[model samples]
Target: MYFLTSTLNLSVIMFLASLSIPTSGLDCYSCSVCRQPFSKKTTDTMTGCTVCSISQTWVDGKRVTTTRGCDKSCSPADLRIKGNGLVKTCCKTDLCNGNTNLRWFKSVVLFSGLIVFKLTHI
Candidate 1:
């Protein structure tokens, strides 16, 4: 009985995740074409996650830039770049390719804060 109740509680918590849309909604980590070691992140949008890996001829290492807001057409198989030193990847889960340090409770609180911010601004 206790196990069932605890499991149900966790299910409820997960079910109540904010900003989720019906029918394939997802929150992906979003950032633009930022340089390595100094990339920005956003988690308020619904879409697939992407990470573009670049390796410049003059640079000795590779750099990765991530983005969100991709549509249904975006898929892991579709992540590609024609350039010799660029490769992109796509994922279909919330912040799937991003850092996993933030806990679920913190994510919920932060997402709530974002909604409040948007409401106040409008």
Candidate 2:
């Protein structure tokens, strides 16, 4: 009986410890391209999260594209560009300034807890 209790306690502790582990993922609060900002209104079904639009520009007469997001909020300066040209800008405002990281962190914690619970049961 003592051995069984010890094993159960250990399992419970391990499961709880796993709950304390930190997991991280990219979340987009706001995105901008060419000085245009997009809110986190758009969601990626696969990730079930909001993402920024891909910024595209013509460089040396060729189309160049880049992706932004994975953070809470982004600005035009964060995009970082050099040179001069008439660039197209696009943006969303629905989810601007949202706490994307916090949301992601909470989700990760919840998922970890679920996993730990399952493991403890096993």
Candidate 3:
């Protein structure tokens, strides 16, 4: 009986752990099709489209860094503050997240949780 109970308890723990979101492995929507879906009455990128605006630091109409892929670890943000700076702009549209990977927030939450746990345990 004890062995069975122990196994059940461990199984529950493992299942719950799998459900927890990880700090790393943040991904978001991507593909140029998001920019202008069905441009000429034809499908491209095979993904739904939405408009999103990015206001990163730009020079000469060029962005510093760019990457795109489906972010399996993406969580929708209602009003995500870009950064603490002199100027910041936030815009949301259907496809805004297609080319962006906003994963830092997850890391922040994880770190905060760890800090709180250590403080309470100590």
TM-scores, one per candidate: 0.34, 0.24, 0.23
Runs of candidate 2 exceeding 4 Å displacement: 23-122
Worst 10 residues of 3 by lDDT: 84-93
For 1-122, candidate 3 gives per-residue lDDT tens digits of 98986677567556545435333332334433333321222312223322222233334444443323333233434332353222122222233344343354335445645755654464
lDDT of 1 by residue, 1-122 (tens): 98986677566545544223334555554444433453335334445323212112212232334343444443232223443243334433464535422244345445655755654464
Order candidates by TM-score, high to low. Answer: 1, 2, 3
Candidate 1 is scored at a TM of: 0.34
Give the poorly placed runs of model 3, Cα more than 4 Å off: 21-23, 28-122
Instruction: Judging by TM-score, tell me the better candidate of 1 and 2.
Output: 1
Q: How many residue pairs clash in each candidate?
A: 0, 5, 7
Note the Cα lDDT for every prediction shown.
Answer: 0.41, 0.41, 0.37
Candidates 2 and 3 compared: the better one by lDDT is 2
Global local distance difference test of model 2: 0.41
Model 1, position 10, has a per-residue lDDT of 60
Candidate 1 stretches with Cα past 4 Å from truth are 1-24, 38-61, 64-68, 77-83, 99-122
Model 2 TM? 0.24
Among all windows of 10 consecutive residues in model 2, the one with the lowest summed lDDT is: 44-53
